[model samples]
Target: MFKTDHRLMGEKEANNSRKNVQMQEINKRPRINLPALRDFLSQFPGKFQRHLKSRFKRPTETEGANRDIFKLKDANFSLEKQMQAWKKNPVWDDDQPPSIEVVVPEGSLCQVNVKTKVGLPPDAVYNIVTDPDNRRVFKNIKEVLSRKVLLDEGSRQIVELEQAAIWRFLWWSGTISVHVLVDQNREDYSMKFKQVKAGFMKRFEGSWRVEPILLDEKLCHPFKPKTLSEYMSCTQCNGRIASKVTLQQLVEPAIVPPPPISWYLRGITARTVEVLINDLVEEAARIKGVSATDLVTTNLNLDQALSNEIQTLDIKERWALRRRNSRVKERKDRF
Candidate 1:
């Protein structure tokens, strides 16, 4: 019994010694010190957001505009200047057709440049194009299936929408659904759009820029605009501002067809642009002719409910995290 007790005491002492040695070795090891990095997202929130947004819009191929189109102000965002966006627009004459040119920027991709000078104000043309409910005016667009405002700044909005567009080839006709993300800015009188997912189009993106063009450019003393407006003031024109509107769109298909089909596709794209521009021109003329009260109360041959209709899926967290159905109200058509 004495021998066993003595051995147990010795084992305990051995374990204690081993533990003490391990503790000493651990204490002797050098520690790593990492420098503290500043969190710009938290510290400089505005700057960080601007940095992120800058990555979204790359400069257009041509050297048009300040590209500072995204610079927005809540109170002082003047539509008069629009940051020199229209300065380099092609001199579009009233009698000529809108300049439409197609360029293949990359493999099987077509980028279309459409520029036209409208007789109406930039704001008038801009309002017609930016309104989602105005699809009725566009001949090719059948309907907007769903529209969601992802981000809404006072002068700017980021919208995600699905559109059903009527398409025809030879004797056959069909409706194509397109999903796109649109960045609409009233400050710059511009809208930038890109396809969210690839379907009929492998890649699709575009920008619409509406800038003021004076009726008389020769009225100014110097090239510098004397007044607050971008277009120089004129006695003959009575501050009558026209719009130099430009649309640059790039569209590439999931599969490129042979010669005849490709040519047909190009024709379709051009005609679609023509329809859009024609719509804007006509709508502006109609508005300019009508009284303010008539303009406000006019039905515009449109469905009253379209402006308020929205349908979208709920956040994945509704089912994934809680294992319960979402509380969101869903339309029967969704099923």
Candidate 2:
């Protein structure tokens, strides 16, 4: 009995030792770095606050006057008259590409303006621009990381989105993450967007405007039925309506590249604007049973364009581009 009791005590000691060892092993496992994560998250609120301050900051008297002048210019602009003027002047060709202008206001604040024509109604153009799933149409955009509706009432909506894009520098490339707050005014067919948070941008803001142009009656040809077998035509025609689309953006990269390179990146930005406008125009034309080739004098194939641009880059840039593309593809496949 004594020997058996001693044996039982020994087994108990061994069991306790093993349990303690197991506990130690569990404690040794890696844990989530909560403090580090919290530190990173703490930065977001400050950034967001600064963005709000900038957005709501009142403009100076001179600035306000300049804004009014711009508004008046836009209001007075007539696409039909411009087209007629171009037709009359040999120097102003009908096949001229869209005009893109850039301005630098204050430090790092870059404003870009793009003017183009689309063969569609304002309503259709507005719908395309305000569509929540814009990534489905715009190929350059890698992903719409997240979209949250903050306000949804009749003609106005406030939305927040997280989007990602891959951009290339001279011999390096990187993915840019942007968090944006968008205020949409459907009544005026305008969308205003500003970046609240970004990984590589200090600020990004933009506006889209779509206006309808009414064609003159003289330019319209009345359809008449001559034979009894011919179908009767309506006497009154409102004539074909064309849409004028304007896109404006202000971007300030977090890390601005050196000269020449910076200019090249700006050029890329302009090209991106062109591509987006062209895509919208093409889609609108398709809805109206018109082919893109008919409306756009110069059609750009985004995939091919991107490929050619990548080829122009040096070896390092090409490698970076490949890596980013792979990562983007993997993310897409995962989703």
Candidate 3:
């Protein structure tokens, strides 16, 4: 998840003055001899550059030692380990409609959750999603104009270069360039991406998540197993492990359009995600030699949908209900 910038204000003038004085004193110290250092490094010709390049290729961190934590990798929530303190909930049906919702309750930016069940191992699914060569699999991505590796750690790309992907919106019959910085991690099977130098959108960021799930109905309801390995190794389950993938994307445009155009914009975004999930599911089917699995997701706004059945209400009661709903949404989307 990504959030906007926030500025910290100093409450004490004394502290501000003290910080200014400290900064002034530090600036009085002699500056480093950058020209001399550059000259010395230049004398080594390509050796320094080669060493620098190789350094980036070395293993940067131990597995599971990353400071940045992924929420999807949380130990509980039926995805990983189990604790008696946590409540259990059943997974959604496989034939439901697309799963997309507003991440923030009041902001211009919106987040979409697209998920589906794939008849493949987690590693196999992970490889397909992270591989740029398979960009053609995503129908929305017309072409990956350019992709470069900015930094690599061992075999994984820690900080990747900007990848310019041309996306065509079928509704508008036009194309837009999406420039993104990808952070691919093989350790947790997650890929974090953020848009760079925005064009169509002012802000765009999200991640890809892959988790193993059992396909059996008896064992899936309430998800009896505590871990993926346990579910996959069950005797009655037949040693099958299907991957449950989730793609979360947050987008914000430079300017808000009127309701007429806004509806089309939302349609374009949701349609793109639909294509992405369908393509991934189809690919999984082809690889595993099985039928395409239907999406196993649920609507996020069921409560609101149910409330629409109310036949009548007072004007004051309606506004009060509106305020209650707004507060609930804000709480859900709060960072």
Top candidate when judged by TM-score against the true structure: 1
Q: What lDDT does candidate 2 reach at residue 287?
A: 66
- Residue-level lDDT of model 1, residues 1-335, one tens digit each, is 34468888999999999999999999999754433234543568888777888766564523222233323232332444432223333122457568989887756557889998776656767877888898867777889999999999888999998999887655578999989999999877999999999877899899999875555544553553333334333332233556789999888999877644565566667656766776666665455553323223334334222211210012233224334333232433376
Worst 10 residues of 1 by lDDT: 304-313
Candidate 2, clashing residue pairs? none
- Rank candidates, TM-score, best first: 1, 2, 3
> What Cα-based lDDT does every candidate model obtain?
0.64, 0.65, 0.58
In candidate 2, what are the lDDT values of residues 1-335, reduced to their tens digit? 34468888999999999999999999999988999989879998999999888766553432102111112122233334333322332121135467889886666636889988765546667788888777767766788889999999988999998888767555676777778999998767789999886656888998998765433323323532221111111212323345678899988887776544565666677667767777786686566655567767663765546644663464347557778999999999999
Better of 2 and 3 by lDDT: 2
Runs of candidate 1 exceeding 4 Å displacement: 1-93, 217-224, 229-237, 290-335
Tell me the lDDT of candidate 3: 0.58
**Candidate 3: pairs in clash:** none
**Alpha-carbon shift of residue 15 in model 2 (angstroms):** 99
